[model samples]
Target chain A: MGLHFTNGYVRKKRLQIILLQMQHIIALTVLFHHSYQSKGEHLRMTNHSAPTLNELVSGVVDRLKSAGPLYYLLLLITLSLVIASAVIGLLAMFRGHEHYYNVTREIPWGILISTYVFFVVTSTGLCLVSSIGHVFGVQDFMPIAKRSVFLSIATILSGFFVIAFEIKIPWRMAIYNVISPNLTSNIWWMGTLYGVYLAFMFAEYLFLLMNKHNPAVICGFSGSVAGILAHSNLGAVFGLLMGRPYWQGPYMPIYFIASAMMTGCAVIIMFHILGYKINGEKMDGDMERALEVTTKVGIMLICVILFFTTWKLIAGAAGQPNGAYPVVMSEVAGHHAFSFWFWEILLGMVGPLVLFILSKGRNLKIMLIASISMIIGIFVMRFNLVYLGQSLPVYYDLGVNEFKEMLTYSPSIYEIIIAAGGFGMTAFFFLLGEKVFDGHKVEHH
Target chain B: MNKMDFNKLQNEGVENVPMQQRRDFLKMGLAITGIFAGGTLLSAASTFNKAQAADFAKKYPYSPHYSMVMRQDRCIDCERCMEACVATNHVPNVHGAYRTTILEKDTSDAIGSTKEFIPVLCNQCNLPQCTRVCPTKATYKDKTTGIVMMDIKKCIGCLTCQEGCPYNARYFNEEKKAVDKCNFCIDTRLARGEKDTACAHACPAGVRVFGDLSRQDSEVFKTVHQIEKAVWVLRPEAGTRPNVFYTKG
Candidate 1:
């Protein structure tokens, strides 16, 4: 009787303690919200200059209604893709992922994971790149800030949308993530920090819309910090797995941040040029200079990435390290050699770098081609990063039939559709944002 | 045996495993160490010391300190333990999902045996990576039993824990919509007052021995504490400090 009572009591007490910990976390979040609002109160006092709520809503409606037939056609196409993909994703959720996704017991992550990484990387990159002008007050970088900020929000939202379906029980995540937070889990940190980052980005965009310089800068800085932390935590999710030799070490997190900066430059150049085309506006002097600087930054970053790739390959090949050697060889000169050479090395780094140089940071046509190439190349790069780590079976050396050969996974048709939906979501939102915000115009203060 | 050509030994497969056969097995003791095939599977010969008995005498973190010791040479891949595990644990019959399974290693270059069967299950580690990386505390080390148990309702279906595990013990359970793995029969038998796991009970060749390591007299403690033969865990560099051990008798 005594033993039974003690067991019951101990279990009850432990559950109470966990519940108490959760309460403290929720309370801290509330306290943080209050403190943030109080800080904003001072800044809000100076920004009575923004449009009233009704005026803002009407203005957005007016701008959206004023779009041409071609804009509507493009919007319709993107919207249909979104709707179709959502239905497919929901079906996968209800019907079971086995029927839809290519992920298996050996390879539980597939294209959706890589696509999610791509979107978030693009989002974090945009936030970091644009913060140079608006948050840090760099003059040449200012013109691209508003549009880049808007795209960052769109891209992150797309990322969340895509991952929602991939996560089989996403609703449980919302409830349990708060009540049962694992402090040691990198995924937990990444999800929580990215949520906070999203909130900051939203606030920054709102402040920018209201013409509140100080609040916008404050939010922008906070968003950038959160983005960096969240993105690195995402890297640690892979890097900290000691079992997976290819992704293990400090290299992944550092590489993620550095590669994020490079991706940011490429994205900033691509969208800025596209934004002007959509609005039928000629590039003004300040805008032209901004693009030129962004291009130069892109060129430098491509070189940086090339250096990183070279060293990573060299390190992997140096001793023909047991687990990593086979994987490195596969990427360098095996089955994946073509992707490595054409997509990753040539198109991702060299082709873009050469094109950027030839453009001399002024030729929009050449810069556009380079940026487009880089985008496709980087997409493949993200795929390779996620896929190659899982290629070598965890027990390859045991000489067991089950784990002897490297695992393989290709995105199913359903997965390809869902991945396309992410791109469609970004495109639709971007087009709407371009029109509604009048090309995200910046006025010199 | 040294005079015998090791390569000329015919692969009799599992049908002719001599139940009474015994060899020094010390030289080939390091054969299973190839499980580290990843280069990090450090042998206990180099790491396990005579001081191990004293270390085993100390109080373990878990009161019962549940553990399993695999007699690597004894398994003949009959798979009765697997059938018992499935029957008891409701393990799905899919290709990759199993509560406990046998891994066969071909030893064309070894003496006495042309093949070896290694049985594997969740280590219920002292430092379980699955529990550490689980975002929602969905899969956690049970405070009382030291078994890595799952709170299925709390699972987000992230599969991050699957990636984190070094032993490939986890699989995404479609019916449950959560990751499932061996819990050492904590719920099925231990809670029902059975002292042993289904796999241990069903292993006909004495390949698996489940016991409480906290008790010095337990078979697990006696087997693991001995310094005469080499004992090791899979992926030791993962630093998970697994409760499961593999050794040759």
Candidate 2:
């Protein structure tokens, strides 16, 4: 009887291991698919010559059908996982289980939440950049302004998609926030301000599409002001968290704004370059000038970011009575040392800065490389800001505190898949925009 | 042309009537009836029975929704509340998930003394900022219960609400494109008419008290009256008029 029981347990364990291996394989496949298939140029090129809508749809279907039983098996697995996640999410909401969350008392916030902030901040930045040309009449940026508006909307929608998966009671959030308002809270103001900004932008874009000049101009200006306030308030959300030493400080809001601008410029440059290449169009003088201006702005922002980072580190190293400074310093220096020195500072900040400077603000090839570098750098900066902030141990003065060791987090395969899905959605939107809007071309009045 | 015609008309002559005669004629015979009718209506409605005031109180009471009033002095900063909140809410492991938490404040002393603990949670303010800035009306306060809630379906995942919150209370669900924060466990407990949150139930020190202030006889009301001087709220200057009250002694 004992031997039989042991054999059964072994069989179960083996099954579990097999399942884990399969999940890993599937995740890797998804990542590969996104990296190649979802890329803007690749997607367009592959589908460009496909004669008809029916042919394209049939081709996609045929490809899936021809992939044999293994492909079908993978499809089944993917569908099951999606269904299971939805059911589990529903159950969690209704049943209210404490064990459902990865968050603990020691680390209150986690990776998913931080990434949400990263996307939204970037989106808001994109909106602001687009507005500079459309509303403020910065003629230099005019060539890319309309496309920028489309990108801003797309990015913001993508940010919203991330948050939808993260929150538990989204319906409740929608209902209470408007029906019951608190005027004094920065969050309230930020939400309302952005809400207003979004409406204004939507109106402005609609007007642009309809060839109505006056309303677009009026709404664009109003939206820009509102966007600035909303973006600054977002920074205040972290800055006001005095308890979290890493987040607290007057510079966080400014840092967020500057970073937003940098990311916006990088995105616009990337899309424009890629779009032009795919269309087989030569780069005009106006487009080249636009690139130059954005690159200069990006380079200057990088310098400002470096200054803020340096001051922050220096302040932490020079410890005070709170012990928060030392704790933050050591976490950056000792535990997250590699991420801080290599990824965050070197690759993310200095590398991009030097690349842009060396490019001399001209040369398409060099500028493209610099822009890509800056984009990667900004992502790394976001990762470090979030992950490193939560790495330190939270200690209590009492005897033998339970949470003595540093908290650790590595993104789960499922989490990574979901993140990749966000990129997929972005590409999908961009493609749809390209197909429908004739690439957002504006006629000169 | 209009100015010239007006000058000719004005020059033709206008006579002023006696002020008292004009006033008397205007009054006519309705003065006594008007006074009597106004006095009767005023007498019929007591201060509490005033229609507009009662309607306002019913619609937008004194407290907002999904807010938790904390007593800082009573808090030991055990963080039981934060743990309970995450477990019950299934909040993703991300920043800004704590619906209710304890904040520890201490000076940087080599000897590690002078530590202070404060419990922080959603203030459930009369003027909730989270609700005001929601673009899709995803974040809102409940009409009946005063609980701030989120609608996931409508949320476009703009982090504007996250940025707007001064208390660092709001979080973005990166995967779903929605905003999240402490809802005071209203959906799980309070929606079903439970008395307190998981944190309040889990707290061993009896420092956290939960009650409806709308009911004058509730413990929250008594505490507010008894320890008026010791109570405080986080960033009261923010003008949120938070429902979450704290007491420090």
- Candidate achieving the largest DockQ: 1
Please tell me what DockQ candidate 1 reaches. Answer: 0.56
TM-score of 2: 0.57
| Worst lDDT 10-window in candidate 2 chain A | A30-39
User: Candidate 1's residue-wise lDDT over B1-249, tens digit each?
Assistant: 654788778897855755544244544466555544412344553344554646644425787899999998899999999999999999887778897889988868776668888898898988888988899999998887789999999999999998988888999888888999999998999999998999999988998999988887999888776655667888787788888988876
| Model 2 C-alpha lDDT per residue in residues A297-355, reported as the tens digit of each score | 77887788888888777777775424246455655667767767777777776887787
Model 1 agreement with the true structure over A1-445: per-residue lDDT tens digits: 5335457779788789888686555333222110111211211222335434434344445556666788899999999888888999999998888889999877888899999999999999999989999999989999998889989999999999999999989999999999999999999999999999999999898777666789999999999999999999999999998888888889888889888888899888998898888877799999999999989888888888888888889888999877788899999989789988999888888999999999999999999999999989998999999999998888886678778777888999999999999999999988987766667777656
Query: Fraction of the real A/B interface contacts present in each candidate?
Result: 0.76, 0.03
Q: What's the CA error at residue B219 for candidate 1, in Å?
A: 1.3
Give every prediction's interface RMSD: 0.9, 8.4
Task: Candidate 2: list runs displaced more than 4 Å.
Answer: A1-101, A321-323, A391-400, B1-249
Task: Mark the regions of model 1 whose C-alpha exceeds 4 Å error after superposition.
Answer: A1-62, B1-42, B45-59
